[model samples]
Target: MTRAKRRWLPALLIPLALVLAVLTGSVQAGATVSLPPKTADEVLAMIARTQVRAFSGTLQQTAELGLPDIPSSTPGVTPGAGTALEFLAGSHTARVFVGDPTKARLQIMDAMAERDLIVNGKDAWFYNSADNSATHLQAPKPGAPTETLPSKPAMPTPEALANRFLAAVDAGTEVTVGEASSVAGRSAYRLSLAPKDPGTLVASVSIDVDSETGFPLGVHVQAKNQADPAYSLAFTDLSLTAPDPGLFQFTPPAGSTVTTKVLPARLTPVPDADSSPKAPSPHGTRVSGEGWGSIVMLPAAAVPAGLTSNPQISQVLQSVSGGRALTSSLVSVLILDDGRVLAGLVPLERLQSAAAAQ
Candidate 1:
């Protein structure tokens, strides 16, 4: 547990297993995966046509985190942050950028930690300069959008988070085919899926299939059972045939200050904090009640105006690069690369009901 404390231990436990990938993405570790022998329904229908093609490479990732049940006042196990994913495959749109590229959600929550997400397509932007805030989420045109998807507690459809990050393979899942490995050099086949109800998932993956240009190179996921760790995104150096809508345009680096909000989070119910489990948190540790960073982030905009965004009110911000502490929750909100704003407190009925709902 040393990679910056396993990158803030999955942003304080994927805020309740961001749809529970804690260990639910499935890959069955009993080791018996070997395929090219076909049949299990033609290897699960060629692993359901693997996707995200139209490549333009550069996706480097590393993880060793698995907080099975942290609750000793959190913070301190090590092994964190080594994620550097980059994407650019087009034709429906995909131009996702993540952490360390001008503050790509640093401070440990890999894949854009302290906020800063701009997923094109159904349009999604989550910018939080520590609470000066910004949100503009639409996400719902393929079918099903009654709103309310804070991190998928019981909502699945957007084609199931776009086929669980592109590995497809559905029949209710249970594959396991491994034994052909190569990764970035192609020549792959390592099918894994194990959601016989491991709560819903804790592993799901598909990789390499060019026994002769059958397409599909790599893909992975691990969620649900907590420490079910395994997150991969790759394109190698692609060009199958797609990309160039001006590469999904997002222009905004000149004076960089644009705001919009709405997605999974966006609450407005307050009053409570300072409940005193000996109270502390924005890093002082010793916490109780709400989880995640446990609270802190202020340099002005001391979060209180009818304060919503809760599970227990944990959206500490204060960003825009002049002062820090861009914390998270409400399905992540760390935008200016969250680091520094922690002067903790979190009970007293959720801080007097979020300061009397601000």
Candidate 2:
């Protein structure tokens, strides 16, 4: 495959992956219940010492990012991208079973169809019932390096998202504990993180931590000027017990088209001796800011030409002064005519300014 084709999948998957990272689990608010009052530092410590791991649960994700409604399947557009856009605009439910770090399964329930991601040891399978297609990937040999799937998103658990945010707590962020609440029928302490910078599109982030186990039960990200959460993922039902091992085993249906790939032990780099030292290489990515206002810039060569030419993508992007932009409640993406793409959890103006500087 050409470099452009290879880069296209990851480029298009970025937005969807961001959305999916915050998408999962459904919240069930119950009567206000009081838990032991703990300081922010104490709660942070609790999260750091969490030991619960194996569990099975039902997750629901919802987004109200002000994105235009797009069909799951668009003519002439890549099928995966179209489907990802559809998920970005709507709510989805999935069953998640995590037995350990290497054994897990996510079954996304779609209307009359289901998409599954099963990871068993070093073997992983992604199957889409709507298309009856499956992709199997095997990890590189022991003691060797590993590779990532460009097209797949490692749908995060609420605990994982909470840890990510907690790890980034800094002087620019304010951490506080809100009222105790309920999530997935369990009592949880509400931990809120608010950015001190007004320039960020994010208003605040709220995490519901299980009162007993310290496991994060839900995550809600609010955007500035948006009353509803830009994205929410929480469990409506949860089980602490380990799931059946059978859930991790997956077999493709009969007659299904299966593509199998064994990841390379090490990725070999192509030498580019003629590349200019002053200019960013097409494969190189750079960040243009910090904290919540950060903008990720992809070099023009890194962007796939097909992404810009896709009719479906164009329909959602509006013509701005310097480029076409996909503006949502919490994030903004700018696709310059020069093919470089910039995205961040900031305003379109921030992206425009970054592009102009480039």
Candidate 3:
């Protein structure tokens, strides 16, 4: 893909991915259980101290984000956009296997076709059965970081999603422990995070932490004023034992077209307390504000020119004063006439103001 084409992928997927990470199946509520109580701080500490490195589980995701359904067969719709819409509106099921820090696999089961993402040591592959295509990426070293593949929409595991929310815990958020519950047949404590800022579209987020292993088995995100969760991902079945080593192996079937790429030795690293903040990109992409109300700004040069003209995208965006907007229960995206794109959990007015200020 060309640079312009690659740039559109993240801009289009990020908003949806932020809300859709983690696959799901049928909705299943665990039975109520009685367990020893722990303070919010203790539960957070437990999650931080978790030692789990390998497991296999069946994950189910459900979203009631109130997004309009866009069929995959729609004319002028790209496969990527179609898949993103499919994930944004309904329930999905996937089997996940993790052997270690460097080995993992996710099988997204569709009715007629299946999508697979496998990461083994420094090698990663994405396969889409619907089109009989595969993309292979090899890193320079065994521990090199892998970039997100554009071929398929990959969702995170519950443990991965839990870590993301936990990292944002601050004075702007209220943390508490809810009632004890059972998830995947294991006793767990419910850790709740409520944003103090009422301006955020998110109302609260709850995570179920395993009592014995301290691993997260589920994550539920509730949107403000919504009766159901805007997004929920949980394991319907779980096992701590490592999966079969053979599961991580992948080979493109006969007649499948395979694309190969070699990744660099190092990728961008997450900044830590001791590290200096990185400078903004040449494209002028930066985040403004803080906490739950923060907004992401991408200058005109960063946004793909054809986004607004795409039929599938145009169907969901409504015209506003200065641009087109896509709004969901948890996120809002604004595409200005000037070609800039602004998105966040904040309201549309917030994005408009940010655009005007620029």
Candidate 4:
């Protein structure tokens, strides 16, 4: 994958996965509340304090976005199962440890191999056990204020999803508290958020937060008219103590190919602008409005060769004219016939408006 795509794909998926990652196992519906659920205002207050600076846990992520039939890996495939694209359609498990924002580690367990992202201070290491390869990326110097990076974007984590959506708290959102529940054997409070905008496809989102420290234990997203969550992530096992420091250290296995990248900070910063680049995003993503009504413009060229070559992709393409619209409860994506891809939390019409302008 291109470095550009690699940089943004994770960020794009992580948050949406909180809202779109669909899991298969039955989520125990009934909760025996050890303590009564908190009020909405109380839950909101707890969210702010739930910044887990040190913790280790095993998280399960499931994606049931009702996406198009995509490709998977075979036995002899080199970059076999668990490719990033495959993350959008199945279930996966991850081992996560966070010492702080700059010190964290995530290990994705696959069928026969795994991928590890280790961040320590300003240096980040991405190691793929499948290929025994590593990518070393240097984040901006500590205390630097620049927002954009020339080489790669910031690494993403499940915790960031909690902060991202919670930061959107405003008059446009309706917050409430659901029944108390259990996650990873710990008691948690269910906090639900629903956009007041009728145009949004998101029906509602509920996050289960640890009652003790307030860290998010699980996130569930429900789409309009859907009974089950379109995406979900929850911990099957968790610990509040710090992770071993050695987990954040990496030397790259012997004979492993290592690629080094230096990220240059952006000259000017625009808030909430789309970071992903496509054919038409020559100057980066152009964002309109904010919060619930925001739309992102992503003009692109013709269909990418990678997509056209895949029979399943081609068949899906044949089902559409110039573009295709995919919708979940919280987001909408418009893939234009011109190869441009527009996405946002707004309705299909909003995305069409952005594409029409391009």
Backbone clashes for every candidate come to: 83, 3, 5, 13
lDDT (10s digit) by residue, model 4, range 232-264: 767788888888888889998999888886544
Q: Assess the local accuracy of residue 77 in candidate 4 as a C-alpha lDDT between 0 and 100.
A: 26
User: lDDT score, residue 168, model 4?
Assistant: 54
Error of 4 at 265 (Å): 4.4
TM-score of each: 0.24, 0.82, 0.82, 0.75
Candidate 2 segments whose C-alpha is farther than 4 A from its true place? 1-25, 73-82, 140-153, 261-283, 304-306, 309-312
As a TM-score, model 3 comes out at 0.82
For candidate 2, write residues 1-358 as lDDT tens digits. Answer: 0111011111212434231232343444556788889998888778878888789999887878898776554321222333566656668898888887678788888777777778777677877787788878666656655544323334567886665555445667788999998888999999998978788788888989889998889888888998888777789999999999998999999988888766542222222223332234335665554456656677776554466776667778999876798988887888888788988778889889888887
lDDT of 1 at 225: 40
What is the Cα-based lDDT of residue 235 in candidate 1? 37
Instruction: Tell me how far the alpha carbon of residue 340 in candidate 2 is from the true structure, in angstroms, after superposition.
Output: 1.2
- The superposed Cα distance between candidate 1 and the true structure at residue 45, in angstroms, equals 29
Residue ranges of candidate 3 with Cα displaced over 4 Å:
1-28, 72-82, 138-155, 261-283, 301-312
Off by over 4 Å in 4: 1-30, 69-84, 140-158, 264-284, 299-330, 337-340
Q: Model 2 Cα displacement at 158 (Å)?
A: 1.2
